[model samples]
Target: MTDKNPFSRRQFLAATSGVMGAAKLYGQGAAGEATPAAKLALQGGPKAVQGGLPQLVRWGQPERERMNALIDQTNLFYWKGPQTTLLIDRFRQTCPLEHVMTCSSGTAALHIAVAAAGIEPGDEVITSPISDIGTVIGVIYQQAVPVFADLGRNTYNLDPEDVARRITPKTKAIIAVHLAGNPCDMHALKTLADQHNLVLIEDCAQAWGAKFRDKPIGTVGHIGCFSLQAAKHVTSGEGGVVASNDPRFGPLLQRFGDKGMDRLAKGGLFEVFATNYRMSEPQAGFAAAQLTRVEGIAEKRSRLGNLLNDKIASTPGIEPHQVHPDDRSTYWFLMFRVRPESFKCERAEFVKALVAEGVPASAGYIPVPLYGNPVFQKHGFFAGRWPLKEQGLTTMDYAQVACPEAEAILKTGVRVTIHEGMGEAYVLSLATAVRKVATHYAH
Candidate 1:
């Protein structure tokens, strides 16, 4: 052995072989030594991370240029405006759907989808229980019953089996929300929808660059809805886009968003009754600029999120969020669940420990399922009574709805926000913090 090389090739091979042999001592340790218990940060141990993670800037020169150009042109209307056309073209380029229409907000986009699906009074639309109210607002406004379905314990997306069981003769559509940018099992959902002859709508509000088995999420369903709210991956202050490939529904989306007037048609006759949900030129300009940065933003976040998951996969008492191997999740938030049996502490205590260890974490998602909300339970929309149920057209009752899995997940889950600018080292430190806290509390 020389001072520079440190060891000969034969010596190096022998040492590595011995290390492999030590790994065979299962339950003892990875290298033939008893593992020491991790010290809790709450008990005066050093924190894993020393400082805050990087902050993401929502606007920059690109957004400024787009807004400036729009202002110079002085065209604020979306109809036949340059900004609107550019936004639609850019959205199609990214999403690659046959037809796309920009709207005022995510709720408006969903309402357009509901109208295009031909949802009428008393119709039933099935969707995940753990989602924003925007997902079901359109269904209620259309006088359709929003049937809440249970979610997968690991993925937090809609469970296809539960959705299948919830399907009834009155079921007209299924809205699959890509919760936290994790793609739902599109294939299974599509199969169920086809068998029932129901329309499948993909709510991709949280999933800008997510893919399901190599296919973009929104394209897998009949109509796809997206959001451009300030908090989403792409922002235009507040806006949305609806896309579709089905010939029957594609044209209808455009008309529904423009107050039932076919702007492309030679003459306007008001063919369908609808409200104006147009996206203004300024919103389109900003959204178009933001859209250009989505690919890079999603790629970086996915890499960091995956690295964090890999680091914590072997941590005792910690269960990382389950994602399909073939799918690409754009990880809006990195989530994990605690195996309560393996830990002495509850979820609240576990999260408190993590935060003390310099990791950004929250207790869980929404406090309750959507059906448990006061509006649904009291049938309070449109003067305090559900007209369909009152008229005997539907017997759906929100108070009777149950989603035990979603409730349980809400009780045990924890999440950390993932941002495009978060570096790999920061993510790894987050993982270290999680493992330290979890191991310290392990029973």
Candidate 2:
């Protein structure tokens, strides 16, 4: 018997608990599966590695030391300090964008971008489902609908063809997120966006410093957003930037966050309605210091990723995401594809096994299905709106929008961190652990 009051609190609690329990089950592995704790028991509980492979946490000492030194040199109020200004100048010089506006977080930058595009209530913005929930919320916060398209099987980026299918007269824009710092097929996406006259926003939050063909990533779309969260390629603890060559969009972004005036001189104190999303100077200072070493950092991360890929690819049933011939990947995580057929145990179980072997592994970043996350599925500012409520809306409504490939990828991918500070030795150890686990769990 189906409960008629599906949205009732008790029903909702039970339903949500079930989903979270399932996710945890997959995350921790099923009963009797070789969990990390089990492996630790077998291996005598986390001893020092004498041979086979080095440890997995060695990629940031030198860089961090240098960054700290620079921070110490700066005054407390050095928010828009010299180093921060210099980094902005460097990006502008390289990308030749008309303007760039920094913000407190990537999500904030996304909000600014959405507002700049004039994404009114009920307007639809098409994006990939294989991304963080922030991507979806950014649209919803603007009172716009998040229309998800599937990702290409190979690139894990928004499939241009699916994007075309989802676009309706109500579609105001499309956000193309380059998954894992691998550049999306911008040429194809651009072609589609132009034909429809829709705004093309690049969610380059992961693909900072990545390149498509010869052109840098953020330069291709109408506007580009980069994240500087701790785990990202470049970080100032938590900060973001919105960039665009479009003269109109750039200033609009600044105004969206800065009390709606774009500058202190624009109007009376506390002028237009705005959120305080501005990036602070210390974060800017840290980011500026890191910017000086970005190329070196990106290069090191690429090298470690390549090293792991080379070793792991030799073993059967494991594949890495394909980097297109023209794409220069600044891989944020060392992701290896685990073919379900190749393993005796489930992918989640395999992850626990890897962790047991002293590797810090995870299920990568499985984007919450645009309609699946709690924010969209239940009450939030977005759902409270008259138009959205009138639509009998939930994230489930978005589930009907197609994107099978993205859904599958989100369900089955595992990733390990390969920071810029890691060396070949650490990578080889990771490769050895993955191989050992796969062998033990061979189907």
Candidate 3:
């Protein structure tokens, strides 16, 4: 019978133990003798995974049909186009959001959210240190300070305690990024945002179908931003969407995305000062079709990812991606970390060994925290000097800013992309490869 209760970490561990017991039994010989260990792939042993894994199919009949329908309609423009409306309708059906505005890119969506929140120059927006620079690009463009906050050791999401500490009198908003499709602790963040009277924006670029305690990710924050970038779960080549349930941000979101023009209004008057960041009808058409395919993609990836995690749970020095009991991570890029002291080899060497075993894996994502980037360190957003910094409202220096936990994550974390096509056996092979490499280097 399916368990009605939520799956806690303790329960996961217990289930994993049973699987491990079966594995141990399978390894025993008929005479009750333990079988000899398999040879290491790095030592000329046969590779665990021999063939190419499944690739995500971006274009298909549904997408073609959508495009053909748009072409037949002859309304290529996004303004009042049926394609854009269809995409918006589809997004609303999928996500637990009341309002959505399609934009040119994920960065544009974030910029719109920032503007809709009414972030003024010199205001501070607290966010994750281990994230794409796009997360801060909008904040900096608004002439606001992007205060870096540390992440949790295991979850890899924004640490609520650290967020609380980073808030100052200048703080106006908090952009909580759900990195790698893992949901952040939204309950804690929502509580904190309410207590501080701050705007909460969710950067769910990687978290397309993820849920936090059964609630859709973007619904928790004041404004939730999504990416339809080529590499994301769903893509329109390049596009973005900003969603919100807050009545205050709904109208502002529409106005900001359409260059401050209220398209729904009776008159053609510019009500607010904003730039054009509108998504094309063609992109909208593609995204609408892609949205239909997301649930299947999420299901397969989640199943394979969970199984891989379970198989590798007992591997020494390796920790599977930490997910909350009530949260469902989409696993866009399956990530894990190695405890430095528990292994004889370094992270690079371990990665090399795993690759030799025919498992595709990378050492880590970004080499340094976003603050260590040249643009931020040089204060180079607007011609090498941010206007806010020039005005002397705050003296925060990115070059000197530090997030120790984020730094440590970059040093030890590893990632492998997850897709819908990978089968159960292929996932098992990945687990075997990880176990072989890690066991060989165990201290």
Candidate 4:
């Protein structure tokens, strides 16, 4: 070994393998990362799906076939097709929603929902600062102001108590998000929304099949928005769906996409002031096929989550995000908050070590707090009082609002995949990787 190059490639591989071996000695499950009999016990019986890891593999072939079938039917004249209508009906049934409309993307879905909610210029919409910029962007797109809310220290979801405090006379709506597919406290949020008569919209981008008290997440709110983006549970390449129980908002939202056309048949092909934000038939068809497996996929993820909890819960400096009793969540991303006092290295370094150990772990999902992003700080798009630019949208107030929990998450949270493809073996591999990395830093 030399100072410049202390270990050869072979030596490095050997040392890492040794580290993992030590971790397995301290961890649970199979010695070579196979599914243990104990894990099979969680499946409940032999009747359970046999192929957990391979289901995704099997599903892939069908998905390709459906995709190809759709491509063969595409026409350059317009995006309308039977596949689009078929998917709309399928989603309507799957979610059991009153009404569903396909949109170009999740952002478009959100904007349509906000508009449908009657959020006009200068209206205030409160939402957690820990989420993607969609909420803020949607509010701004509708010429409304977004009021940032704080998240709880325990679960990264928006704190209802904090949301209540943020409500002012100007507040018109509240956009609540189910972060990481964990359903938010809809009861508490609904109570507050009712008290204030505010329109409540559920950002279900991370949650497709999550439930709160046996009721699906998006259904609890007045309106819900779901993404079918590439990485999402139901992939449509780029698509979105907006659902609402209210009859009034449903058709209005439909009009938002088609420029005020009440019906699809009345137009001379583009009568409404609406831009072309319709979902493609091929994408919609592909997503419809994927939707058939959402429930089963979510169940497998839960089983894997339970296994990870059993093996890695006691590991020092590792605290997986706890689920509330009311929430039956769909796992989008498996998250573990690091207790750095018990470890020698930073969360970033720890994530790096886990990646090196063959686990796809990383520090993830840090949002540019709504008020702090360059989009709001420098106002060139909107018409208002631009303090910094001498003429534009009003400058955002980043002061007086703080999110302790969100700040910690934005700075230190680590994440890994909790996709349907992951299994008991993958879960054990992750646990073993975490243990090795934690112990290495502990020393």
Candidate 5:
């Protein structure tokens, strides 16, 4: 009954036992004997995922308490504001970076990192080709070039080998984007950055609370960027945080997000040119509250995600999302690959079959590589003209750019929705749904 240990051990057991009880009903098929999913639901049999997913309760009392505290505050500014201060304090407890800055959006956090890292016009930054345009928008706006590298077939994160091959004399930094909350192979990437004397920026927008090799993901790189957009693991509606333990880039984060004026300097001529991307105190407070829930949310999703992978591992032609044993992927949404040759169905049909069996599954991620977009193909940045290429500062041509593996990934990847505290029974049934559909559709 202590404050720190509020729940009794018996109560904890009772709660978990209920979830375990349901799991027994949805286990994999027994050898030879008929299982509940022996007949495929796509063929007029019962659906596997009985009892739809539990409704999500993303925010409530914790968020409201923080909001109430803000209501009595005198200002909404972020400079030394208590809410912002508390948010940063709470964040550091999790990520533990010496210098941190909360900003307007994840894109802003990265732009600050790139600008702080001193990327200049025509400087090349190697990154994944199959990510949200936000991953490169900062580099482009800084007048730097984003060298799109191929990715791993199963991991769906940047391929370190391809990254090393893309490195050139102009490479000033490498932005390692942890796509779908899966940690990139940071060890190889960090080695490449150090050997080449280039900065390594970890784009961790989707990977809140994820770890690489037992160390928090953002810590291994020089700078780490995260998103708190509504879709992320934890959110403040629209906010971001950038952090770095490196003294070289740590001190510059604040000014880059605050109009380039060093608040620590009190009153001095603005030396750095930047925009106002500061996050307000209200958003900061809300984000601080969300931080309290992140580790719990991450753990639940990680466990459930791995369980789904375990449940579906033996299905023919299916490649479960590949996560390193030492790394923790928060699984914003579990993305797996389906071998085309082993299936008698197209990707769309395979996804439809899973849906019919009551699994929330969909084919592919993005439709094409970042360079495949018309804007890149047309060399149309900055009102339909890219100055870096026009001024002869760069010789890059996106129209000729290609990453075959990345292109194939978007064609074969299947996204399965997972959530915080998703019951194990439901996860088991989701696996059953996949097994049923995959078995029926295999050649």
Candidate 6:
């Protein structure tokens, strides 16, 4: 939270002062006529976001110093390793989990969590159809079925009711992905899990400082998985952490992440099989430094994304990304939708206009839901064959899996960049860019 900002005094002023003036000017023109700000930059008019955006400085001297300290360590192993210890401690300040294991990547963290949760062959893990493949990689690896569930229409997260419907006797766990750093409806999901006696794993890779109803995301579920990928809120170049308060799974995290070795018992006998997914001390130290910036970055991004949502709330064809007012979404990115019949232009044209106006916007998020991928469609998870299906242990068929709402969301969604480097005025201008394009093309 006390991380240093890289913006110089003048750069700060340039981002703040100039954009503030632009927002004030956006309201009117001579004799209250439609201002030039209302004109689309696509029409050769003035761009809303002038001077572009200030550069973001993700790491600096603090990260450097941590790496320097890391080099002095005699061994780089994560077991009782100092850097890993500090990294976990810093992470605990925010998440407060009793048992944590740092691993090579978010994918590894998820696999470790799944194995620790005892998700075995033929078991089903219900999760949203609109997330990174890493979210389900572990389930597939464990020879479990990843049952695709429909998402909340607005939240881009798993709809608890839909998840409930998809649950079967074979259901072993529910993986709630906090998509776009927005927390899922954990209360309802947790209730369902309890009623069904299933494990709940929170995929928190995208949610660094996100909170659901004021509770940190990872604390609610049985196991929490986080990413430290280069693009995430924090980074150790590439790494992850899996943790839990549930004693059933907590003590097993280390074993699962470290080739099924029980370090506590000095790893003599192997009851389960696992792969090597350890993190080096250098990465742990770097991540520990990155943790310091989490709060500051999350708070700033939250403010900017919320500002953009508010400014564009009334745009006729645009539906602002939905985030609960009580939840802190940190908004890794804002995803809103455009109702096709409400506008005079196609989604591609609309996106072009916004980008021309200097809004960092794109036509949609993912091209298709995760289930629609070639591998899923063809049932080729492992070397052009799925052993689970071949053995008939599960009668699952991915080609028939349908999550229409997720499909619709991806079709209509527009992804807008929102980061901590951005100032309020820049976000306000982004709002103006959306309004200008939507209003000009209003049918």
Q: Give the poorly placed runs of model 1, Cα more than 4 Å off.
A: 1-38
lDDT, each prediction: 0.82, 0.67, 0.82, 0.68, 0.85, 0.85
RMSD, model 2, all Cα superposed? Answer: 11.5
TM-score of 5: 0.92
**Model 1 lDDT tens row, 366-439:** 87899988988898877887788889988888889999989888888899888888877888778778767766
Candidate 3 per-residue C-alpha lDDT over 175-248 given as tens digits, one digit per residue, 9 for 90 to 100: 99999888999999999999999999999999888888777779889999999999998999999999999998
Q: Residue 120's C-alpha lDDT in candidate 6?
A: 86
Model 1 TM-score on a 0 to 1 scale: 0.91
Q: Which portions of model 4 miss their true places by more than 4 Å?
A: 1-61, 64-80, 264-274, 379-396, 399-401
lDDT by residue (tens digit), candidate 5, 1-443 = 11011223442243223221123223333222133446777778888888766788999999999999999999999988999999999999889999999999999999999999999999999999988788899999999999999988777888898988999999999999998888998999989999999999999999997889678879999999999999999999999999999999999999999999998896688999999999999999999999999888888888888778756654667766777666788888998788888789999999988888888888888888999999999999999999899899999999998899899889999999999858888988888788777777767
Better by TM-score, candidate 5 or 3: 3
Q: Which run of 10 residues does model 1 get worst, by summed lDDT?
A: 1-10
Q: In angstroms, give how far residue 217 of model 6 lies from its true place.
A: 1.3
Backbone clashes in each candidate structure, one number apiece?
0, 5, 0, 3, 0, 1
Question: All candidates' TM-scores?
Answer: 0.91, 0.78, 0.92, 0.80, 0.92, 0.92
What would you estimate as the lDDT of candidate 3?
A: 0.82
Best by TM-score: 3
Of 3 and 5, the candidate ranking higher by lDDT? 5
